[model samples]
Target: MEQPKRLSRLKTTALPTSLSDHAAAFDRLHPQVQRWVRAQGWSQLREVQTRAITAIGGHRRDVLIAATTAAGKTEAAFLPLLGAAAARQDRGVAILYVAPLKALINDQHKRLEGLCADLEIGLTRWHGDAPQGPKTRLLKSPEGVVLITPESIEAMFVRRPASVEALFGRLDAIVIDELHAFLQGPRGLHLWSLLHRIDAISHSRARRIGLSATLGDKQHAAEWLAGEGPQPEIIAVDGGGAPLKLQVRAVVEPPETSPPTADLEARSALAEIARHAHEILRGKNNLFFAGSRANVEALADRLRTLSEDGGVPNEFFPHHGSLAKELREEVEARLKEDRLPTTAVATTTLELGIDIGSVHSVAQLGAPRSLASLRQRLGRSGRREGSAAIFRGYIREPYLAADADPLDRLHLPVAQSVAALHLLAERFVEPPSGDPALLSVTVHQLLSRIAERGAQRADQLYRAIGRDGPFAAIEPGDFADLLRGLGGGEEPMLEQAPDGSLMLGPLGERLTASRDFYANFKTDEEWRLVNQGRALGTLPIVNALAVGSILSFAGRRWRAVAIDDPAKVVEVVAHRAGRIPKFDRVSGEPIHDRLAGAIRDALVASDMPAYLDPVAAQLLAEGRDMFAALDLARTPLIAAGKDTHLMTWRGSVANGLFAVLLGSVGFECETFDVGVTLLGTPSDEAAHVLGALDGCPPIETLGRFVSNLAHEKYDDYIPEDLLRRFWVKRHAHLETDVADMIRRIALALS
Candidate 1:
């Protein structure tokens, strides 16, 4: 075979001698695959691909390929797997390709079909939105690959156990896409249980190959991917691309001389945003990541209006979870088309790699939720060679008058975001903190297990759920208590059989009967926004309009003329400039201590960051000035007009705990971005507060401080003692972290 031109230009970690080795590895692939590669204008395999083929084809152990987006990770995993499947020629499903998003599965299904078809290998898709024809055909044949989601797998196990066994009985491997997404939370726990259950049932050792772009700590991620199974080998592939070009610019709003009008503030903010988007994003294929769904809608609407006013083509679209699937797909499709220069204002929905083609730049409308999230969004840009990945971050800190909110005075958001950008530049991404004790998932899996195989024995249930399960940390006694609470209560979830077997109770049956039971996470009751009987999209019922309320959605403004509560529908008419509604944020993903520390350090550092634009630079300077004037960095606990501020300078979880502790002890307190605030206190007693905090109060003693502790899913079902334990397990490190904070406070006070 002739050496391809692109092969000579390939940049790989492997040395010159290793080029022959890589070639030998490529030649080992099936002849059809070789021809396919040559037909596609031949290029040498990526270093990650070469390593992946070796590990997967050799059948050494489970594999993890950590590479950048659009780096041909899919091809890397599939090439060797397909080769192995062809060589082996087993009847049952050759591979189980699991993706976090159905959209991803659909995209991969299209890409993989031709490759599979050429080799006479069958490929099928199984998801809620997928057509039934392919699934039924797969049921009959049970061969090749089946692309699916974890929820679909749960549903399959519950609804069609026999079919699942028949289809996946001889599964060769489980390839997990966007592997970092499933490393924590209920979804991660659900995936863990599902994989374990599949292994147990199939009695076959299927290799697990995990893939992701932004896995911070490779070791931790590998341990997470290897959960109770044989450890997976890490294939670390450098994200070879252009250097990242980043800038942090503050959208400075005019100062309120004396009580600014709300309407004027909103309008000016929108106008400024429009100007910024038009200035930087017009004509270029880019993405604007809004902090929230409401922000996405608002910004997209403003950009569209700017385009109309300027007589430019409307290239702006809103892409978020609240938007209709068709609308989101339309935006995605337009982005992929070469001629269309479109920009999508989106939430975290578009952060993941979903084959949306190359974006010229990525702009953050506000500070991202976390550094991990920021890194992921930044990865969306700068894919092409000889070009830097452009990231323009816009943080808006409203100008405050005298007597403005103290929080606003802090300018914490801008400081945090600027600090986050610095952290990203230093290549400091938060590693996944694995939380294995997701009782909600345990509850879900319990229901699913019993529903799938009716009347399981208590011991058998314990063995499945406790002994070797993902929730192994759950004590047997606690499991028993959980069972009693779930089964024997007024709203019983499980029924005990005469032979001491467990089955779904009335409530459990009702829950399992619903389609929503397929997922482990809890979804808020939502109302669908409709205009002229056309379904717009759904928002949480909590965010519903109250008769006269107005909100922006799908890049259009709508006024709620009527609301049908029972039907969960909001009837709206086209309107201009309604207040953007508020919705509850998904909780429990805490900021790592590193991020908080970095932000604090940034504030104290003398060097000004070059990435900060004029406004951002001003804000940073103002914050630093405040820090020095108030002597905050030196004295963490200070008093300002009968209000004592305890500058904990800690992450959310720590700050939250401290605030709760103070409030529980009957001190009027509120949480600040960088610290805790106590009201009606004098400067002289600030030392006393610090002294008291030095000896970290026991969590049990601070139980009264914990009010409205209803955060986790299925907490309602858990008993009081166990729930308390759950909260402490997640939030309380009183003896270690809190005590350390107290000592720091003591030192500062001294």
Candidate 2:
């Protein structure tokens, strides 16, 4: 069905009367919609909303409502969508609400339910968590909006492919929420392919509307949201609710910890945080983002213990994927009402806008993985007029060297983090890079599509997907590699088929696509720690964990469980009472590489940055006195402290290169925070390291560390195959202009 024709002059009411006669239409909105808008306290329509209504509602284009969250984007997209559906479909779900998380769909469904309840249109949520009854009704009646998660929609795509044509025949639009979170990674790519396929089967065009909060680059995001460069109506939000109030502080416990000692472990930084959290989160509603789900569980237990000991009500709660959905949802709902005196210690699960009430404050337990996350957490605070983020940073103070960089100071990391947040909040991150790991996700999805379709012809399948689409850029070589992985020439698609026909095999089926095959996000490597016939969730199977050691698993301490190599399982019995710090990842992309350099420059400029924190003040004073005495900052090779110490502000990777280069010159070099310390002999070694490194000899002196590596996902897991791939790739761009960056550093230092 086509959109209703614009029979006469249509103009926005707000437009001046002289021009209104030719083009005003908004003032003519149905009386009920006008009333609804007024009651909702909307003063006027947003540009995105007006544009959507104009381009889509007025002309009926396959609209793409690409805008940020809390930008009234949901209403803008849906109001026109609902209007379009009202004109045509009275018998089926006209709108499909698909989001990555169930919480987002739930939030949208409820909001729409109130609006459409009396409009004779029904709303139905379909997901794994949804009851079978409503889904059955939607299948039977095929009316109203069917809110669903991507996985559930993927299931429907397989189980009811035939019904899809009928169910979504008049499908007006699809509203994808929290789009930025899923759209780039494997999950987004999978959804995109599924959507393209859904269009193929439905025989109806569904207007796509993607909603997100953090849109770093709107143009690129729009391109991804609308496949084949659909000329999506780009809707950059103008007036988001409010700006963020951010305050980052690092709490240092009494008694210094230079070299890690047993007593320091007992009195950990977490203890100091627990002390402050008791005061900071007393009256305010808060959400503390712990980077790991493991940390969520551990922090919950700690908070519970704190409440018990302090005789205060337990306001903190654990929230993540591991917790039962019912429990998690209930907690979330309660949090929204502001009646529940609770603070959720969560992973990124709670990061999206799920309307968990006007939180008075937000807390980050430790160094966050990215500046993007830090900004999101900070945004959660001061939702009302005058609230601020109670961000607290905690680091293991015990593990330190005699000469730790000022940046390692507890407060310095937080300060640098704040600076990074400022850069990100302004919407920049070295800009967005194209997905390098997209092939992995594509492989995952291809396997899933095959599983669902049962058996499909190679040519037909490839044509259906690759022709005139995002995969158009995908090469024949990569496709061949994927086909091979899917049990083809080298990798068998099915067990018996040497010809590599597309069939789901045991190997291909074990991937996530088998589980649902829809989600493309990377799964973490975990070792299920089991003890005494019970399951402990999982421990990160990193080189960070060693055998014969007692470490925290889940919330309790367990002795180095028997490391089952084949099973990749660790079996252990409870040991003493100690906990390992559960950190999911430590990724720092400060505003720029210059931040580290700027920090060093700041140290030299004045004592202000050094004396900012009490503990850092003493450390800085000692370092500065030493620096002046040795004249270390001025000279590359200085003997101010009675020995030759090389000071280079070339950053970590470069400093590491210097160390490797020193070895090339036959001089063993040790790296310190400020510079490199030459060991053994400096005369020949110093010349060798510099000659080997500066001359750009990949393997002349350093031998095989460059090409020895294959691939490594984890920092410590730099396998021989990985390490070669990483540094060669890591400094790939640097190879072009690094001479200048290095030369500048060398000249300045020299």
List model 1 lDDT by residue over 1-750, tens digit each. Answer: 323534523334544326875797797788888777777785687777777877777765778898877677898899988878877756789899999899999999988888798888888989989999988888888898999999999999999987878888788889999998888777888898898888886757788899998877766677667777655767777755668787887875675435668766655655687787787787878989886777888888888888898888999999998889999999999988847889999988998878887889999876654777887887778777666788988877675666554445556667787778778777677765535237667788889999898889877888887766447768888788889889866769999889889999988999889988898776555568899989899764321123444445665557666776446677988764332212111122356677778777877888888888888888888888777777877788655555666778776667767765665555555444557656556666767766765466777665533433333456556665666666566555545777788788788777
Clashes of each: 0, 34
Model 2 error, position 261 (Å)? 11
Each prediction's RMSD to truth: 8.3, 8.4
The segments of candidate 1 whose C-alpha lies over 4 angstroms from its true place after superposition are 1-17, 257-267, 402-410, 434-437, 524-590, 732-734
Candidate 2 structure lDDT: 0.57
True lDDT of residue 604, candidate 2: 56
Which tens-of-lDDT digit does each residue in 149-189 have in candidate 2? 77777676666766777787767777787777764545666
**Model 2 lDDT at residue 331:** 76
Model 1 residue 675 lDDT score: 70
Error of 2 at 186 (Å): 1.4
lDDT of each: 0.75, 0.57
